[model samples]
Target: GPGCVLGLFTNRFFVLRGYDMKTYDRLNRILILLVILSFVMAIPAFAQTPSSDPDEKAYEEAKQDAMGICPPIFLRDENGNTINPVSRVNADVPYSPKQTCGKCHDYDKITQGYHFNQGKGEKMTKNFAQTYPWCTSPGQYGGRW
Candidate 1:
């Protein structure tokens, strides 16, 4: 009797330690639950949702499919005005994040002595965030380029 009981319980012990019949059924339920959880976790990758953010997703989808992508970020043009030219994102170059044109002016605070004067059709202007009537456009945001 002892040998039979030990043999019968040995596999159950190894597979689902300390579980009685009812508890073993519950343990099996949990194993199934874990498998289901893993299955659900894999769904998002296949969904093929937009890129990093909604705007980015919109930009890529609209690049040619719907409305065109918003014109590329502007840099200075022939007459010193910010002009948006058609340029593809350079995959070969390193990526840098730039939100506003003024963000390009790296040495403004240090180069106060050489403030660039506009000598062309477009006048150069800058905005300090603290100033009132502040504009969020490229030049208005302290854009350097």
Candidate 2:
């Protein structure tokens, strides 16, 4: 009974055993023709140039405007004093990057990022604490090597 039902459904849909060799060959050719047509229709979309879009052109221009070589900068120490390499008073003092770059950039905000902070104030999980006894936090600073 099950096999008869399956045979009826297959014959009705021409899915398995109902089609003659000629019908199957024609259906295969039509499927191949449709696939080729779809690829042909997609050719123009793939061939479009990036500069053809006004939005993309504007984005490229803006990106180019933002990226450039840095100009010469005066290095400053922790106390905001300019460090002259040859100056006797500043000869042995190390230049502080925070004071120098912080003049134009937000040092605090930049350092607050995950990469710079390295889990300094993050919570320590019980499993992590048990695994790395020396680590005080879940990240690189106090956690795994």
Candidate 3:
């Protein structure tokens, strides 16, 4: 009687058509086993420490060294004139970052970097060319957005 009641309850609420109690029990056991396996697999990921890669270690050290030692910045205009905010003559002109930061940094070399270039002259793969016919390069500059 108890087995019949349980079967009726499972069938009514769970709507497990054509599956007997044994099949339902097996499915439950399989689901439980899969959940346990997932947790077991994730343990190694949770236990991981910082990376041992040389490049990553160097990047971290450099980041730490550069944290709070920045000097005051002097904003300069396109013609290498210092932009005094209260001055009337060059007050309206926009300060050029290339002229300002470029005093210490190389503008040409920095703009030639991967991010700024954005695949402007890179060769496209055959599959990518075929798939995206409008694209001339792999990145945003020459490729269709």
Candidate 4:
């Protein structure tokens, strides 16, 4: 019922029925003790260091490797061809972005992305321009026409 009175103590809420002062006081103390016991049980979990988690350690190592802080592995194609991103089709050899990078990864979706659409006629949103006007400014390195 909307008329029920709620008793709050130590971040917990409990309903008080029948205006029994003794029962309410007893329930309040029980709830407080339960909260304290829960916190005590969680102490060992909180004390555990970040290095104790193998997943976290692995993620940190991967991040370092990706950021070039750690050595990078040379990737090769299925046919033992050294994967070189710089290789491009020469004159009279017709090549597209999809034809190039698509051999190893999906380049079609990447080409349609915002970063690759730099010189394209895609209009920058007003919010984007307001947030990062340098991207649209003429003198900046990433400036669009």
Candidate 5:
């Protein structure tokens, strides 16, 4: 009945009926304790494994579909939105070039490749600069022999 007060404790709701003040107080305390215990015992859910969980599996498949190139291992947040998505699984240095990546690629590739070969000289292609893996603005170079 709607008038019946049921308490959800220990993962189940029990009707607190026919109990005196002392008994009701004891039950209330027990209920509070059980809730606290359950909360304390709870572990931080990590979306389980991509195999064991159906949702994660679906997300993994969706990600694989969304990403045509090599897929990087990223994490799904609590809201089920993907966050901190990285690029590929191997070394990111080649893609995120700091001082290297040019060691093997060289100036010819950098200057003549899709990034700088448009005859813009100092001006860069906005699209290329934004999409190109590693971005280096001109006049930002200080390399010398």
Candidate 6:
């Protein structure tokens, strides 16, 4: 009797030319067993328990839930007005990133960061992974923005 094979693979028909039904069933069962084994083996890699101790893991989870996450606070301008630039519809008008961001954060401190300085002038002790060609000379790693 010729029939469709359905399980792990697609509903494909194996031609029963010389092979019997018993052999086909056994092969299908083997394929299903292999798929199940593969899934079982891959479970440990995906299911990370974080900590070894169950109590500690539970405590860490509970602490995260208890502490919770802070909601984003909508910032206001110096005039006590809510400064939402997204609401403004203008094609010609261009807003400065520094001026807009400085309302909540210090823009001056951000300009003095590592990226601002020239790559050749700086003397860095740490080895940066990305700066391979430029900083390979001596003691250098930082890049110019």
lDDT comparison, 3 vs 4, better candidate: 3
> How close is every model to the real structure, measured as TM-score?
0.29, 0.34, 0.33, 0.27, 0.22, 0.27
Count of backbone clashes, every candidate in sequence = 3, 1, 0, 0, 0, 0
Q: Name the 10 consecutive residues with the lowest summed lDDT in model 1.
A: 1-10
Candidate 6 on 9-74: residue-level lDDT in tens?
Answer: 332334435665576788878877887999999999989757878999899888788667533444
lDDT of each: 0.47, 0.70, 0.74, 0.57, 0.48, 0.57
Better of 3 and 6 by TM-score: 3
* Better model by lDDT: candidate 1 vs candidate 5: 5
Q: Which candidate number has the best TM-score?
A: 2
Worst 10 residues of 4 by lDDT: 2-11
lDDT of 1 at 6: 20
Clashing pairs in 1: 101-143, 102-142, 102-143
User: How close to the true structure is residue 67 of candidate 5, measured as C-alpha lDDT?
Assistant: 81
* Candidate rank order under lDDT: 3, 2, 4, 6, 5, 1
| Alpha-carbon deviation at 145 in model 2, angstroms | 16
Q: Cα deviation in Å at residue 132, candidate 4?
A: 65
lDDT of 3 by residue, 1-145 (tens): 2323324344334444666777656666676677789999999999988777989989988877776555567678999888888666577887887899887789899877777679887889999999998887898754375
- Winner on lDDT (1 vs 3): 3
- Report the C-alpha lDDT of model 1 over 42-142, residue by residue, as the tens digit: 99888886567889877767776643534445454333444343464332342232323345545455334333322223433444333533333324233
- The candidate with the higher TM-score, 2 or 6, is 2
Off by over 4 Å in 3: 1-69, 86-89, 119-145
lDDT at 138, model 1: 29
